[model samples]
Target: MTRRPTQLLLATLVLTVTVGGCSNQNHTEAPPPSGSPPAPPTTQGQFTLPPVSPITPTSANAAPTGIPPAVAPPQVDAAPFNDPLRVTTAWMRQFCQTDFMEPINENLSRAATYATPAATAADITRGDTTQSYQQMQQQKLATRCDQVEASINPEAPATPSMVYVQVSAARTQLADGRPFQRLPLASTRRVVRGGDGRWLVDSAVDAG
Candidate 1:
């Protein structure tokens, strides 16, 4: 049978994956019993997708090999040319490094701050997409993973206000418990430029 997308599978297939790794959210709850099984429901080996190129952090479109760069390059030969790559990579670092803890309301609020005005809070929370990160908070899962890597989807369509970049990360720990062995996964995120000329994540299509 064809595999489901990584976003959906990752959410249900279960793990304490880096908390901010996927999408979906819920109000805070007491921590689930320790070793209570990483995810509420998990079915492994069903979701899959073709691989994209690995990110090289030292150059353009590189995801942080781990702990993203301290900041974007101060100068670019041209603003239009460098903004997409530089901004997208920087956002990925913040996106992946979230602590996945309570003030559940505030965590979700902060996560959404990166969103475009047009992006919906509902979708960011429980929309039918690959992210289960939002809902993961409801379970109060703890994690030890930090860092991420991403690449520019040169082929993604763009407009004066919008762009897209694809990112991939590997889950190396099971501190939370999951149905499958640690594996690499990816997502194609949509970003938009705000009035301030700052780029923010508008939304994303997980490999679902």
Candidate 2:
């Protein structure tokens, strides 16, 4: 009867150990399967931006490389008519020629280039007397036989821009090479600086 009681107690102990082992296996975590992908990580409140390219700086007035600069045109020199005495002498030689062979209007036109508008008008009016005198000489001689010789004398002026000139002219017979007129004609001329910075004959008046 004592052996039966000990065997019953041992049976109860084995049943309790088996039940505890099954409960522990139910609560424990299971391992992942072989070759399966891992779970993704959490990324709350975080972001990544794409990369940006760098910019090159340039100037507004800078010329581009590998091109040549433009070349400037060559400049021309202007005619010089700066002197007072030189222009005055040139004017007299051009205007006072007593050539009946050359056209008088052509001579006057060339002379007007060296004078102002007022001076040019005055010179044209004076040319009428010269034309009449030349006609009279041509009728009397019946050939081109007379020429006028001129003498120029300049007086000191009040200003650098103005000059007073005295002209003495004589009519000579080209055939005999002697004075044809008894008295030499006298005249006064005024030369002044023009607006364009060149010297010009401004006026001429017969002297008494």
lDDT of each: 0.48, 0.49
* lDDT value, candidate 1, whole model: 0.48
- Per-residue alpha-carbon lDDT of model 2 for 128-179, expressed as tens digits? 4666656634533211111223333534453667776564433222212222
Question: Which candidate leads in lDDT?
Answer: 2
TM-scores for every candidate against the unseen true structure: 0.43, 0.43
Superposing all C-alpha atoms, what RMSD in Å does each candidate have to the true structure? 24.8, 40.9
Local lDDT at 34 for model 1: 80
